[model samples]
Target: MDGLNDYRRARVAEILADFTTLQFYIAAAPVDPPNQEDYYTEGWRALRQCAVDGQHILNTGADTHVPITKGGLEEQSKAELQQVHLDALGRRHQGQKIYLRQAAAQRWIELRNGILQGKKPAAEHQASLQACDEQLWLELAQITDEGIYADLQAADIQMGRWTGEDPSLRAVQRWIRSRR
Candidate 1:
């Protein structure tokens, strides 16, 4: 069980790193030896991919401004691993098919909630987050100005903000800055 859990965790990480929303959806389950189908054909695939991305960002190696019990690599019990798997799968099965664009919009909500609740850290993470925010903002802005809508579209979809449709230059800029 431990080995399987580790493998699955690694798989999830790779999926998150490899996809951006524009790529085809790689089905994680409910199918035999599931495989990825390009979004050009599978609409649902895009949504599932978006949810995966959202979960990854929110659960990055730390709390999303809220203290959730640590799990996965840091966890020791099978129950913890199971909970992580179930949580990820449940989100995929529940909720409307999330799109990358919608996911990005949701990031703002996460940030606001985290801040409103007074989720603060010792000055260390603050500087790191600020730098990350600035870098991502600049990159997104540059991409937007270059008229790289496809990239933004992929990012939006991966982030699960599908309802927002195509990402606007302003939205991408706002989302990037609002992070951390």
Candidate 2:
């Protein structure tokens, strides 16, 4: 019984550590733009490469390959992303950018500090960070894609949701950065 209890505790601690690291990678301003060394970003890189090369190993162990496209996937991806962003912004309420909840902003500051100091975030911090992420997605959802597009000027094209110097608010409106 003692051994099993110890194992459970250890497993919980390990999970918390991993979660903290992920939250740091996502919310930490220090690693803004997400370096390749950050967790899970490599998957996107691999997918993008596969899209361009027209190949994917369905089973890595078996080395089974599948082709997606012969070429120009990159360009197509850009265009689609641009269109998505334009569509989203076209529905914004007076071009409103990312808004952070006060509680989340407080947690964001604390989490960034913990990440910098290499400390695991407290459970409450994790919840707050998660809430912040959820709020952002919810706000994005409100930006209807079917909104008027003709009203958009070239200057209205915002780009990139890079993490920032500001803790209270993020510049998520400038998402996609297609630079049409």
Candidate 3:
């Protein structure tokens, strides 16, 4: 049973080595603007490979076929490099260039930090909702049943309502009513 576990561990180490090689290749590849998404996707894949590779490297002994090299220095370096790659991928995967939620969260954090540090400007220390101008506030602000009916009438282009007038709002409303 121990031998079986050892054998499995050795296989895992071998697989990890392959994965690390793949990651190195991905990291070394050049990126094109239009294919940036593809490049990032590949980067993520590479990071995943590195994680698997590092795990197997740890699982198997340094004396195994997977060479740790001169007190495991090379393997250690590779593992560290892979970890950096993984972190980079994780940060990148968190959002796209114009993600709304990420931008909002970042903005909120920045605002909070600035306020906490007393760096925020006196005029803009906190986010505020702009009040409606009193001059612009009219009876339209509080819509009436008549207004809703008028809007429904205007929306109906066809004379489908009870009114027979071709261009009247009621006619349009009637037309719409028939369709529904």
Candidate 4:
């Protein structure tokens, strides 16, 4: 009985140590835009592992008395950390959306000019415009934040008006607006 209890306690301690390491990694993850998705994925994985290990420790029935909040393993702390990761992801996506919007606008102008000057057929111009619209919609879809999604929807509506591309643009606008 004594040995079994000792083994359980040791196991709990080991799991807690691993959980703490994951916590540190999550807290210190870089916010670089290019690698933001990878960082967020790693942070989310670590958070999930910590939660699983914490549950396992609780199930062991060992003489574990660690206070989660004080030790930086509390549920509230995890929630706060997850929020930080989410906000970082939102910022990165927002920056990407801005860049894509500008590029799409420039491309639309060039395509329209080509069509008007007979450098390209109207059908070719329309196809190019449709591709650009699709790319912008895809970029917007990658963002998960509701506020950012709403902002992108408004921007897309404006872009549609400026480019005089109504049908496909209106479809994208409706889809984005309907998303929660």
Candidate ranking (TM-score, best to worst): 4, 2, 1, 3
lDDT of 4 by residue, 136-158 (tens): 45544554445545554466455
Tens digit per residue, CA lDDT, model 3, 7-32: 33343343344345544443443333
Candidate 2, residue 34: how far the Cα is off, in Å: 5.1
Model 1: runs farther than 4 Å from truth?
Answer: 14-75, 93-96, 100-180
Model 3 quality (TM-score)? 0.20
Which 10-residue span in candidate 1 carries the lowest summed lDDT? 29-38
Indicate the worst ten consecutive residues by lDDT in candidate 3.
Answer: 129-138
Candidate with top TM-score is 4
Model 1 lDDT, full chain set: 0.38
User: Model 3, which residues run further than 4 Å from truth?
Assistant: 33-180
**Candidate 2 local lDDT, residue 142:** 48
Count clashing residue pairs per candidate.
20, 3, 4, 0
* C-alpha positional error of residue 104 in candidate 1 after TM-score superposition, expressed in Å: 19
Task: Please give each candidate's TM-score.
Answer: 0.22, 0.24, 0.20, 0.26
lDDT values, one for every candidate: 0.38, 0.32, 0.33, 0.38
